[model samples]
Target: MTDTRVAVIGGGVIGLSIAYHLAEAGVETTLLERGALGSGASRATADVVRSYFAGNPVSSALAVRSLEAYRAFPVRPGTDLPLRQVGYLVLFSAPEQVAAFEADLPAQRRAGVDVRLIGVEEARERNPLLGDLPLLAAAWSPQAYVSDTAAIVTAYAEAARRSGATLLTGRPVSRIDSAAGRVFTEDGGELTAEAVICAAGAWSPALVRGAGVDLPMTAPIEQELLVTDPLPPGTPEIPCTLHAASGLLSRTRGDRLLVGMGYPGPDREAWRREVAERFAETYPGLAELDLHPAVTGLRDASPDRRAFIGHLPGPPAFLYATGFSGHGLCNAPAAGELVRDLYLDQDPGIDMTAFAVGRQRTG
Candidate 1:
């Protein structure tokens, strides 16, 4: 398929994965990044990998595919992923939360999530910092995992390189001539490709708009993690805890305990105060642990948290693979496979109609 060259805009995880998959599929692929690869939201991820969607079964299924891909990646030919199968627990703080969680249970089970609701005592037994915090219930995902996102990106990039893909960093695309299947950079460098995939993360709107399509999205400065120094001897590593109602989540990163929420910097005082109060009530020792911000960046939010994963309608034929919100890193592999399938005009195995760029949003 000499005529099927693909130029993937954005060398972040999604773009890189798409390039890797495309090149591996024997399509000539080139990936462009303004800076270093995986230096964007890919690395900014909270890194907790799980498949338990709140209500979206399709999204949950994609997540399950992605997590399975990561789990099996190391054994695959040219990859080394530093993945840790630490469990993930979503706690119910109130009765309403329990009800809300129950609504999600059916979808979660449908997505093949190995989970169950446990009592507060079981939660505390698993997490030492969990004092008698009056948690009503908790959903345990025993197969959930975490990883160094950069490492995974590196593995994808390495695999793509091995597959004969060209990776160009410090080269940003300025325009795309969708009609001519061409990509242009600020330096006036141009490359013609059969397919152009927009995976620019937060910077995608402008690029997609320039390509004669408007992909409605938001790039919010998300405070994803509030890390602390190494935990003391008493405080041991615990599963990733997401207090869904409060939006406060915690997991161990090496020796540090990471507390995270979506609060902005202007509300740092309020955020820390609330997190501290919650820690005091639940996790005792980490209550006073000073938070150190790490890998916080803009989250590419969409109408729903789910990603848009289909081809943008065009004579130029562009593929939209951005808008994953906070799930970009974990689902990169599945997204890559989908991009490849779409490019080759093959069935994606998963139903992608829900991810289609709607008629109202597509200009």
Candidate 2:
């Protein structure tokens, strides 16, 4: 029997997932949160879940596994994750993106995601709004959809508690003492554990930097999914869309359409204007698009476009799981499970060499 107590810093979705899995394995765990659970990026998520990896097989594998886990979550005691399998459609305007995606198809299949390339006719039949636009081809993954991100966070936190883990809120962690396996909070309280997992998202750099680790991760403004007030009656289903060349993604929220793009540039005001100007050309059906207040978020971008989910070379207790490069939700379930394995010193049963070799490998 093991009596190791793990203290998890940052009670976001990733942290809560780790805590739940650790508790399930009978390892004592406690989670500390600066605010309520998932008040960070998790709350700001666009909620599109799919495994259509353009080229990276690691993230694709994680997305595939996480999809099944998400499907099984709501039935596992405490959850209102509201997972729906509407559809995930990726439109390729340029031939180069289509070629790249075609090359990645086999790898995506090997990673266990069954997506297929379909003509724009079928794509428009599914999402009707995409009729006669600059469309070369589209990848249609029928099983992908959006979920209530906040609900998922709540569910994970509840499941962790049900599994006999302690969760505290509104207390920020000041520093981490890796050598002594202790986490010092801003309130001057010390929490000790045999291991510590940092799932602090954008705020992760601070915690690890103090312990002499250099994370090449940056916090960028994510201008995602500005919702339209409410659509007219009989509006067609808004299939979850990823514009390949434009870096825009959107999903439907009942009578509203939530749209956003991945442009880490200046003011969101300019972005909104650009999107508004190009909205009708993209979706000519919607004669008038009235936008609502944006649900802004932040993304942790990595230099090498991958996440870190291993222990620091210098300290066994100082482990990390960040740098997801704006694809955190899609990778959460598998990433959480992998973090669980690392925390318990068990085999993750997957190749993590590339994932472990990202830019932020530090002590």
Candidate 3:
């Protein structure tokens, strides 16, 4: 069996970030990916980066930190990532939805986020493509942006390799002998380390279960559709906007608009048609836009909708850094730092109890 200081499973944005941080800190790290690097959720993401969580302070703080890292990509990863500051707009139709955001507005402001609760008129001004809907209020975060996720992942991988981290692709981890700090790959390869990190994205639940840890995680298939923008050229482009009541997510990509909605059940066709209908209703002005078939991918989420970023209960050597739900790309940089600090027994400088494994879920 090969030996290393730490063995990180998965090669998505989160895994790559973890490996980069650990290696940069002078640790001997090895990363294993079942497919090519960024072949999973990282590649399938919507690529919108925003730091607006209605109620969760922990997630917002992590996102702010990660945004800083993204802003400093040239210095941190030594590669320039394509980022467009298109901003994020969340339209709320219900009073309850507006109240929830108003309650958390203070915390977000204290975190140095320039988020504002604006009236529907201002919201429509920010996104001219907004239709005449019953928008009670909107949360506008001007610092939010759209990023090139694949480029970011590649930059992290390059930085990690430069820092002496070994990344092994096509190595599907079969099981983790966590008690012994050993990882068994499906291709009959074994690697022993002082610690094993499970950052396997949607596959994290099963991987940790094999180590006898029942991680509370769910893998839900989220879908996104690409549609042509039939609006006039003089019309303003739309930011990443979400209809809070309907769970509809829409953002612009050059001349096209990418739209999707988070569905609770397993019916793919039903979800697709529902999202299409919602899109048509929401953007009545874009009636002529051609709606393409949705591209579906799995996202892992916890019961509390927060990521578990600390070590396992019984086996301290086995750590988890998964379940970012739909926010992995936006929160990956801080996640890498948190995992690195946890492995090195250093303070991550934030209240991590909210992200602790087996924490009681209230939200």
Best by lDDT: 3
Candidate 3 lDDT, 1-363, residue by residue in tens? 448988999999999999999999999999999999998777667788878776876788888999999999998878988888998899999999988898888888876677888999999988887778888989998878888888988899999999999999999998888887888999899999888999998888888876677777765555445555455676677888989888888888766787777753667667767777788778888866767753556577887778988775344387889888777898999999999998888999987888877687543
lDDT of 3: 0.83
> What are the Cα lDDT values of the candidates?
0.78, 0.77, 0.83
**Per-residue CA lDDT of candidate 2, range 1-363, in tens?**
112378888777778888888887787888999988887777677777877667777788888898889888757634656767778888888899889888888888898987899998887787777646789889988768678777778788888888899998988999988777788888998887777788888788888876677777766546465777678899877788877767666677888888776663777678777776556566767648777655656667677667877776434377888878767888887887887887666789897666763434441
The regions of model 1 sitting more than 4 angstroms off are 1-4, 265-274, 313-315, 359-363
Error of 3 at 306 (Å): 0.6
Per-residue lDDT of 336 in model 2:
76
lDDT of 1 by residue, 138-235 (tens): 88878678787778788888889898899999888888777788888888888787778889888888888767777777655564567776787655
- Between 1 and 2, whose lDDT is larger? 1
Instruction: Evaluate model 1: give its TM-score.
Output: 0.92
